[model samples]
Target: MSADTPYREELAHALRVVHAASVLTKSVLRSLKNSVSAETKADDSPVTIADFAAQALIISALHAVYPADAFLGEESADQLRKNEGLAERVWQLVQQAQFSDVQQRENAHARLVFPATKEEMLDVIDRGTNAQLKGRVWVMDPVDGTATFMTGNQYAVCLCLLVDGVQQVTAIGCPNLRVNPQNPVNVKVHEELVDESGFGVILSAIRGEGTSVRTMLSDGLGEPCKIEVRSSTGGKEIKDLDLIESALGSTSLSQAEHKAVAEEVGAKWPGTVIWSQQMKYIALTLGATDVMLRLPLDKARYTHVWDHAGGQLLFQEVGGIIQDIDGGSIDFSHGRRILGDNNYGMIATQPGVFEKVNEAVKAVLARRT
Candidate 1:
């Protein structure tokens, strides 16, 4: 239960669970043959086969180990239950998944026995619909960047363990992210333009335990290495600031407000735009960029807990600070969404420049009013 201790057992279990999910997603991605189709959700977002398979794999693995734990996931089993064709696709991947490969490679402590039938697969996915903020709930986003994933670019499978509404463990698998820091991938690289050599990466953290970076392997995850956030030196000059944003324009802070704030902070104009909320946080964790912001265009747009739960913990554990637009700490105590009614945006940066950027954000947002 303690995040400070090695939590050797918990971290190992989570890595195994997430790594298996990564394998499932990657398999689906490779099968796409350079192009794939998606089904639009009620929210107008895209959902691909990879998303369903990854969520089912992760939840089933965790459920096997912790039967009493609750799950809050992005994709539910309702659609799969009603559509036999879709259920078959997800079930095929689940049945073909080799949990033993991951266990043997990473020496992961958790072992999963795949469900034998489509009914079982649908049941486990449905289990993820639970929206509870009580003790020992796991929040997960099987594919954080569906568009990016479909395009064969960057995407992440995110999972965070929240105990009593507090973030404790974070596990994210970035299958398309590069492991070598020297050859950093462009945050905005298009799918057709992505380099195949980038391979994969896995980032995880426990509250008190430092964040760990590992390369994702075909069989399982690589050995975990500790990672820390680098801070900016000298005074808070706008010129020294760098930005990380969503490449998909609509998902990020208002471009106009972002430009003004970046200009005010002396950050490079426009900043570095990327895909996937989870990947942006990973880039920040790696010291590849400086600031990350998420300002919804509408008042009703809520930040889902599953999206930030893991990314927020990973960033903070690496010396970064994350807060809402009003400069308040992110409250995970609410249900599935983080303060849905409040609808404040999010800002992430190293502690050294957090206040400076916060002030700039405040000024620009004030002018908007």
Candidate 2:
């Protein structure tokens, strides 16, 4: 065990977690969004069997690896299951919502996510809310790219470990992500030169250590190269550099807000935003693009900690950085979630280039304040 020995160990663990998650995600995404039915969660957002399966796999792994760690996840059956008495508890949490006392479980079958059975439902919910949350707990979003997963496009299985509250590590498995789950940082080129459908990308990062990239086809970890944030003077720092964002297809991001950032920064702004949930950060880390800005669609409901944890570290793991619009840090400690999850927008940029982007964002915030 040398200087990088510990890092290598962590890298391996993070890779393992993401790979497990990717296995789950790929299974779900294979059907695309066609097979599963989407239902609104307590949050009034869509959730599917893919989401349930992905989270279940990650939780199962965490329970096996470190049982005592606290766990916080987005989708849980605990509140919706009857035998577990979750429905009654949730009814209270939501201020007296109602559920049916009618025939249950087996009958609801085909249309619902896995574990539609009463006993299975209880297990899912129990696993979900079972957080004692003392030390090194894991945070997960089984299928972070719900829309993409639903559509059979791109999504991710994200898992991160937090000691006490600080994020220590993050593992992202984009089965459809198109990159190797192996060491992506130095894996060379993309599997498909053109970012088309049917490929997966893997990006992993640990706090303090840099980020790495790999394609799905590559194996055994190639020479891991260190990537830097877009440079300030060279190909990286040309002031108004190439901007990459989602296909403008997902409603999660609003074009009106993005256009404003480009206007303020005077950026050239061009490139396709890789659709994979966690792959967005991988793209930025590898120098595919400069920044990824996400403004909250709903002001009252903030972003989830699980939502950004993997992406945040990937940039930091590489030569990039992510900051709230206020230039303050994003809070993962808040077992509670980001405010309005949408109120605080995101800014992802190469190290030096970020300062400029931040300057532009501040101008917008100052005016709003």
Candidate 3:
């Protein structure tokens, strides 16, 4: 179909699908997200049961709904074979009849053998690693923030419907993290949580149209709450040109040739350090923050599509912009959604000011070397 197709109905449905799966993720994440214990992947990044369960939930649910649609997720064949004495542990978990929460189910993920062997699980997770993205492909990051999720912070069930590399529909399920992370009731539906104040946030955007937020639910998603960019007048307002950045995630930017760019130009405003994931974009698009920067330790080293796709759509639809250090849009065309493909070190801001932002960044880069 063409860009922003009228015939494209799958995006909205997919949004609901992820929200359904997010319910499992939220419950499971809440239980295990607080676990300080973790495992490091070959890439030296932290991964936990939350990531595995989230992937399993998404893949299983997607297959049930649309068995024909191809899927691509992060955990793959390499992971299944790494640990020893893990097979029996997996079988024990899988053989159990009921799952109390997502964590329990995930702890037993090795048991839920699809074809045979743990590598099959990884293959399922890697279904989209090198996906033929030119047609209708479903891109997913079962858990967008592995580290954040491990710390009981922010993370997401990040998924989007990309037709020919253009994002048509975007869905981000930040179950525990707030739309206003500080205020859970920003727009979450009070179905399962039972607390009116603990509303879950769902940010959705239809390309070329606009973005909105509402209660995340399985039965029916509530009405859309329209969003727009609020200006940071260079005064003392937190909402002005200030940004939401993490000292850890910003490591690469600090070592970059232009390390002092943001704090130098934008007056280094106060920020709340929520874990990174789709929620950061939700916060940015929903007026929680004006600018959001991802200055990784190695600007060129670590980056992924699952991290930015949902946020990019939300910010763009809500009148903001996201791009690389050089100001070009991040590419999601690589079906596998790997690093070194598109924009890594990213800067997101309002649409009109990106030109100025780009210049400021370039100026800083030039001064360094």
| Model 2 global lDDT (CA atoms, 0 to 1) | 0.57
The superposed Cα distance between candidate 1 and the true structure at residue 112, in angstroms, equals: 1.4
Q: Best candidate per lDDT, number?
A: 1
The lDDT for every candidate, in the order shown, is 0.76, 0.57, 0.58
Q: What tens-digit string does per-residue lDDT give for candidate 2 at 1-369?
A: 246644455556566545544644454444444344576777777776556545554555455555566677778773355223434332232221001101222354211123333454336435756343346667777777676567665566777777766667776766654443343332322213333444355566677766655554322233344455434424544445656666665656556567666778776554455555465765666555667777654466466677776677777765577777656677666564666443366787766777777777666555542
Of candidates 2 and 1, the better by lDDT:
1
Displacement of residue 271 (Cα, Å) in model 3 is 3.3
Query: Which candidate wins on TM-score?
Result: 1
Span of 10 residues, lowest total lDDT, candidate 1:
182-191
Model 3 agreement with the true structure over 1-369: per-residue lDDT tens digits: 357576246666666556655665555544453554556778787765556645655565556556777666666535545664443333233222123333334455332223234544445555656456676667777677666555555667788877777787787876654444333222322112222234266777778767666776434466666665434422433224555555444444453333355555664543534456566776666655556665544445656666676678877876677787755777777755435436557777755566666676667666653
Per-prediction TM-score: 0.89, 0.73, 0.75
Candidates ranked by TM-score, best first? Answer: 1, 3, 2
Model 1 over residues 1-369: C-alpha lDDT tens digits?
354575556677788878888877777777776466887787889988778878878888788778899988999877777778887877887876754454464545435756657888788888888887799888999999888788787788999988888889888988777565333322333223343653477888988887888877776666667774445523446577778766545654587777778887777765666678787787777766778877666567777888788888888887888888876788887887865356488888866888888999888887865
Spell out the clash pairs found in candidate 1.
238-265, 238-266, 238-267, 239-266, 247-274
Model 1 stretches with alpha carbons more than 4 Å out: 1-6, 99-110, 181-199, 229-237, 297-299, 340-343
